[model samples]
Target chain A: MQAGTQKSVLIIDDEEDFAHTLAERLSLRNLAVQVACSGAEGLAFMEQNLPDALLLDMRMPAMSGIEVLRTVRQKYGMLPVLIITGHCSQEDHDRAQELGVQGYHSKPLDFKELFEQLVEVLHQK
Target chain B: MTDKHFMAKNLASSTHELQNILAIIKESSCLVEDVLQINGKPRMKHGDKLYHSLEVIGEQVDRAKVLLRALNSFAHAVSDGAQTCDLVETGKQTAQLVERFVRLKEHALQVVVENGSAHIACPPEEVIEALHSLIIQAITACTPKAPVLLRLGAQQNGQALAIIEVAGAAWNPEEMEQLAAKAGGSVVLAPGVCTVQFPCAASL
Candidate 1:
């Protein structure tokens, strides 16, 4: 990331501890970060605040990542969304690809790589 | 397409949950390292030890991830009744799936495949089970701490083959014959050496 450019990132995941811990790590890198423990909360947060990039977990209670992606695209067109998942089925993968998310990454991620990707995505805008 | 085993569903579900848990453990470790790297005093006494401990945690998490992935692959092996799989890769998966069992016996497994992969059209679960049975038999017959080696290759005529060799394993031709009959492949058993053929191998 460029000096003096603070990228804001929102992570929408059902895993509470994981979401927050990741948020904390990212925040330490000079980025404004927030975590929503569910798709609904993430949407509510989005209604008030929009981050530069969003990381959405694939499987969630009540609403899946694809469903959230659909709603996000409809409500806020062209928001850069990245898909994060533990294990994704082919059908969900195909759907996520169709939705035009910026990237799809698996869990147990390499933190440095993910940060690099976040930087790249932020730079694109 | 039918679920071959009632246990597979639970195994698959459990592995997914474990993967997520492992991911959190890793991220938390990374967070610790991040803090240390950024703000730790230059002369902190325990800094190096803490960094080494965090590295160990990261390595173990990576190791667990590999095992979990192998378990997940094993659980889903029975998804398609007629699915074709590469013999060499399947051999490696079988080795990974039996990690705990080998550890309990104070043993290890090594898979060897020369050059390109070999494909077999047999049912995936059956192939896995057959290779597993051979490995278990070899482990039991071998001396302590001996590595159970699975050699995957092809015959001169292009048929795929698998051989299990554990030094000092008791020779048992009868059991190998029966397994061979079921798989429509030939078997040759000798002391610490067993070779099984897969007649339905698509290619090498």
Candidate 2:
């Protein structure tokens, strides 16, 4: 897909394998995908090159997904961000909604649902 | 109550009690088999504690099985006759059922599973179920950003037992004690962090 036609997605997750696999899958669908191993790294990358949407993992070593989401919201208001988490509790879901997360998905991920949500968010934006 | 009614109720209660006793015997037998088969050196210092915990958990499973059997027997007594059942497998199956819950939580979280494959004599299901409760408790106690290091391995001593150690930020003594009590496990505050240990014995 051409650069202008394809949407850019930034995946921020601690799980290297899961992140890579996801990036590969999304890339196959003709989306430009960039990955960061941690929340801090993700923030730095976002500063340099803003993606169309960010897919963030909730749990991590240093800064959490929620922390990253908070930072992203502060720096770039109205940025479309998706919170991806392994454990999806009610509290997490509620918090993600409160923090203006554009989407949320629990692992083991439902790729179809995630893709649809990502497309919906990008279209709206 | 009428004589017939009283007799029926008494029979039901006795049947239930008998089932529970039989379950305990079967679980104990499996544990004995595990103790015999386990080979090599253990890792943790508290071998006895791990063994005792596994035994106790097995015993509890047996008790639950017996109770369930009694309920089943009461129904049979009221309608059909007493039936022969495989209590050993029942005990094992029950353990397995509990383990499923534990396995799901363990995989979803960032905890590491260290150690040799320590199978419980009781059913894999039961161990997982009990472990699930313990895992959830640990997850709730952890700080969001802090790393929760989970170690599952044998004690340093030569024993047919497995230990699950969840290490994280220092937890409230009261809260840890409450969680431990609920999960039938012990919680200790280690030097650098809080640790909860869940012991499982080999399953025959």
TM-score of chain B of each: 0.83, 0.32
lDDT tens digits, residue span B56-79, model 2: 766665555544543443333333
DockQ of 2: 0.01
The best candidate in terms of lDDT = 1
**Candidate 1, residue B90: how far the Cα is off, in Å:** 3.6
Per-residue alpha-carbon lDDT of candidate 1 for residues A93-115, written as tens digits (9 for 90 to 100): 89888888888777787777788
- Model 1: residues >4 Å from true position, as ranges? A47-50, A70-81, A98-104, B1-5, B41-48, B77-89, B103-107, B112-120, B142-148, B151-171, B177-204
TM-score of each predicted structure versus truth: 0.78, 0.40
Q: CAPRI band of model 1?
A: medium
What candidate 2 gets wrong by more than 4 Å, as runs, is: A1-4, B1-204
Global local distance difference test of model 1 = 0.81
